[model samples]
Target: MEFFNNHTKLFTAAALLFIGLTIFVCIVPALKNQSENAPLPNAIALSDEAILGKAVYISNGCVACHTQQVRNVDMDKVWGSRPSIAADYAANYRTDFWRNTATVMGTERTGPDLTAIGQRQPSAEWHLPHLFNPRIVVKESVMPAYPWLFEITNKVKKGDVVVNVPVEFLHGQKGKVIATADALHLLAYLQSLKQTKLPEGIPEPNFLYKKSGDIGEKTAGGPKELDGKVLYITHCQTCHQSNGEGLKGAFPSLKGSKIVLDENAELFVNVIMNGYSGRVAEGYGVMPAVGTNSNLKPEEVAAIMNHEKTNWGNSAKKVTTEQVKKWMDAVKK
Candidate 1:
């Protein structure tokens, strides 16, 4: 009681108690957890470019909109194959004394979870323009554009990586768009954000949830007529506009495209199936392997073909799933 009456002694005692509690409750537990969650021997380190890109991501405040974590819930299945675990972030460490930040693990998700964005949207073709203007790809997207990371030039200059921007999105800029080195680095970082495969015994995605069924499921009467508009919006519309008129130099217009109007569907099928890289259209960036990446089914491919052909004044006959399957089989052979 006498000791408590002395304000100085009481203050000293309280400070000691708080310090001891902090050490035991916070510091000790954190140290023990760090030891337990040590990075796996095979954990990959970020490349110099990727590290720079990570800094760009942090500086740009991307964490404010997107979350790096995938929670352990059925709804989060769309974000990643499995819920994130402590070991997943084990490799995230301080590169040096000055830079101690790692593993952003954002709280809010104004945009989608980016934990598996590398696997989900890996194409530089898609990412570049999307970064420039999210509305270019996702019309409904509210993500602010990062146009400063790119430049408009009349001449592409050899070796310069050009971004495919539709004329409408260019805001009257009469020139080709090129991504800056910082943009490339940021893209590399985004592509490197694939979820690390967890060790065995971790909870995997619950496949029981039938939110949207399989990519392409058939009904009794052949494959159900998939909503071509919906499919296009989900996959193709980002590069090619809803009107079938693609961005001027970035993506080729599907409306008057020879490929879309061709009598034989081989070219269309092959482009969708394997992907087109050669100079099919002059001055256009490479088209990522959407069919392979998205694992689009035969019926789904047929539906897209039919939609593109018929819409935008194309007036071409609808393609059947059997036709797409035959072409796919021939390609495999």
Candidate 2:
């Protein structure tokens, strides 16, 4: 009994030490994080109305549907941005905001992340309609409308204000006006979601390229010499990339491309000068008209086209100035 009594104080001290260390490891870093990045929340400070909308978001169980964080690997690859850092959670970490009180750092992502919501859809008119009735904007969205939130917001009796109501607003069955403050504050919060900065330490993907064909097309009937590499690097490498892989859905691949191999080399020259944008199996979404640049001379466009066709295993006939000029005339017509 005397030995047990003697060791009780030592055991108590050890227990207290463990508790203190645990608290320091978890809470102290969170506190330091709050101090270091607290201003980020203020970057999109919640106004009184925004605070109310937040409450509405909470009350409507939106947290059950949407998530705020974007995980690193998944987000960076496809979303063009990275996940949230300590800076993103500075406000919730420090103060007793709705997130802190409800402990609602939601898990499910029934909808896309709200972290980059601002950049995803920047138009204020679009947001107004989406909130009133999501289906009007997204044909398949299953979210319910908050028609009760609507109230006649503006009244100008002297002169009828030409208010442009968005098509989505017409979804409210009862022709009721909306609370502008609610909509505006929601927009402010959404606008704050634009974070285009990519993740640290990750590099953007690159495009592809192919080799040039035989060079005996000149009158010499021998390998003709042209600084095709220098010409292409200077003029076309920026968008097409040296390897010719092309940006997703944007740029077309020139490596082993059918267009480069076409016997109708005149069509190739014309496109280089004028640019064609109907469609290619693999291409960037749109093709800008080369002549539209106004600065590229017809000869320069021809040189770039010749360089691409010759270098890319596409042993088609070389492009001539006459072919380029003819295509230019056709484009003007």
Candidate 3:
């Protein structure tokens, strides 16, 4: 009571209490984190251009819609190889005095998670047009276009980076789409968002609540099927479409296609792994090397092939994983 009656004593006691808490709660954890977490071994530092792009990403409020973190859940396995760890963001610090931290690990995911978007979709060809107008690639996409990031010009300068957008989405403009510096920068940043592989021998965190009898390859004991439908949607559906009827004058329809129906399976595998630029004369843009970029396994390729062969009313011969591996190895050679 006597100590409380002294105003100075009371004030000093409260200040000391808060100071102790500041050290224990905030400062202690930060110090511990410095020792506990470090950037992944294979993780590359962001380029100067990517840094600028990160600023653009932040300014455009992309953080509001996209998430950078992949949670430890079975559903999020599609987003990343593994759940995000503290070390994943160890390098994400404030770029400058004026800017906030670049660790925009957002909470909400209105759009797909971008934890490993760099690996999933590495094509500048796809990203540029998609950025110009999401509807250009995905007909039912709800994302708004950022047309301001591009320039429509008939005279493409030597150094100008052209965006390969479809003609219809160009509003009949007589000019090639050029990517501005900002757009390229943003792409660099987006491309830099690949999750680093964990060091070998260190156990990765398992996803919780994984369903029993999940799809995978048939091994020695039993058959575990990989979901070809999921793989198709994740990688190819945007360009080829869910119905296999690709965009007219853009992506070639996979339905009843000669390459798909052929028993050889050479061209189909080649196109998926190395991409198809031969269709440029037929008014289609270059298909990205999805198989290579996604690091798809032989079993995954077989699953996608089987899915395409069966879906969209096409009754082609189902390809086996062993068959796919043979062609995949041949192509690499």
True-vs-predicted CA distance for residue 255, candidate 1, Å: 2.4
- Show model 1 residue runs off by greater than 4 Å: 3-44, 70-87, 95-100, 136-139, 150-181, 195-204, 212-224, 258-270, 322-333
Question: Cα lDDT for residue 14, model 2?
Answer: 85
List CA RMSD, all candidates.
4.5, 14.7, 4.4
lDDT string, candidate 2, 11-126, tens digits: 88789999999889987986676677644423555556656556666766778877776566532222224455555555443225444532345798787556655544454444
Q: Name the top lDDT candidate.
A: 3
Q: For candidate 1, list the clashing residue pairs, or say none.
A: 164-250, 166-247
Sort by TM-score, best first.
3, 1, 2
Better of 2 and 3 by lDDT: 3
> 1-333 in candidate 3: lDDT tens per residue?
899999999999999999999999998998799678988888899999999999988888889999999999888877887899999998887778897565989989999999888877665766788889998778888888999999999899999988777687888787988999999999998888888999999899988998786566666786787989988988899888889988776678999999988889988999889887887887676786778766688988989999999989899999998999999998872
Report the Cα lDDT for residue 186, model 2: 62
The TM-score obtained by model 3 is 0.79
For each of the candidates, give the backbone clash count. Answer: 2, 17, 2
Best model per TM-score: 3
lDDT of each: 0.81, 0.55, 0.86
